[model samples]
Target chain A: GAGVSQSPSNKVTEKGKDVELRCDPISGHTALYWYRQRLGQGLEFLIYFQGNSAPDKSGLPSDRFSAERTGESVSTLTIQRTQQEDSAVYLCASSFSVFSTYEQYFGPGTRLTVT
Target chain B: AQTVTQSQPEMSVQEAETVTLSCTYDTSENNYYLFWYKQPPSRQMILVIRQEAYKQQNATENRFSVNFQKAAKSFSLKISDSQLGDTAMYFCASTLQGAQKLVFGQGTRLTINP
Candidate 1:
């Protein structure tokens, strides 16, 4: 079975630039999540989608951060006017359902660098 | 809000020896799930083991096992016969029974020495 996959494994952008990170969840997965991991830090919850709708967006750091999922398959995280503080690894995960019993499979992640 | 903590920032163990990583969490929810995830230098997060808060028995996966203390709010991972492949950053996470979000602890970097 295919695991969750993310695009643009590595990205370097100047401050104030905008970037988009993509994620492809496993087939049939209805739940998708996004997280941010700063260097040597723990994972910070971002946003999650159950099907194509997002139920939790409180984790978004600010208005510049947003995410969307379409067709209940692929998701995109967009950071507008990125700041150096936004530099980190963006991770994507997917699960069969929203239940806690189900394990979320993670993707390799996209390492975003803001210069 | 739920919070997870990893007291140890780093640890090391000789190959074929045993090592233990400690984790604690604070949550008001009674029903939840606990997990241990490993991330290697490649930056791939892998599920090591999981424990259900409602279960009394600890969860074990071959050489990896967890001592889950629900009363003390402690969940520790024990690796026996540690291998070099086990060298990585270990994170402890938890989520409510019906919740979709997880609260993760500061990772513990485990180094396996030969």
Candidate 2:
């Protein structure tokens, strides 16, 4: 089976521009997550969606970061007015459910460089 | 708040040797899950192993095993007969039961030389 997939493996944009990163989870995965990995840093949780429940946006660093997911399919993370600090590898992960026992499968990630 | 810590920033060992990566965590929740994820040069995060806080017995997956110490709040991953393919960044993470997000550590870079 295909694992999670992220589009635009690499993206470069101006500091003041806006960028949208896409993620396609496994066929039946009901939970999806987004995380940011700064250079030489660990993964930082951004947001996640579980089935029909409300998405958890607490991890969003600022109001400029937002994400949307319809049902259990695809998810898009949009960054408005990107800053140089926003440059990092954005990763997406998914699991069968939100249970801790279910392992999360990760995508290759999209590296965003804000110039 | 929950926090995970990986003390060793880097580790190196010869192929077929044994290496252990240390991780410590602090959390208020009594029941949680600990995980070890490996990120290769390709930047794909792979699950290495996982341990439940309530399980006193360590978790093992072939050459990959974990030393879970609930009282001490420590979870260490031991890779026996390490192979070159095991070289990657190992991240220790924890999350509450049924939680949506995982708290990760700084990660340890493990290099297996042939």
Which candidate number has the best lDDT?
2
* Clash pairs (backbone) in predicted model 2: none
Q: How much does each candidate deviate from the true structure in C-alpha RMSD? A: 0.8, 0.7
lDDT of each: 0.95, 0.96
Candidate 2 per-residue C-alpha lDDT over A1-115 given as tens digits, one digit per residue, 9 for 90 to 100: 9999999999999999999999999999999999999988899999999999999999999999999999999999999999999999999999999888899999999999999
Model 1, A1-115: lDDT tens digits are 8889999999999999999999999999999999999999999999999975645898999999999888687999999999999999999999999888899999999999999
* Candidate 1 deviant stretches above 4 angstroms: none
| Stretches of model 2 off by over 4 angstroms after superposition | none
What's the distance in Å from true for residue B60, model 2? 0.3
Candidate 1 C-alpha error for residue A5, in Å? 1.0
Per-residue error for B31 in candidate 1, Å, reads: 0.7
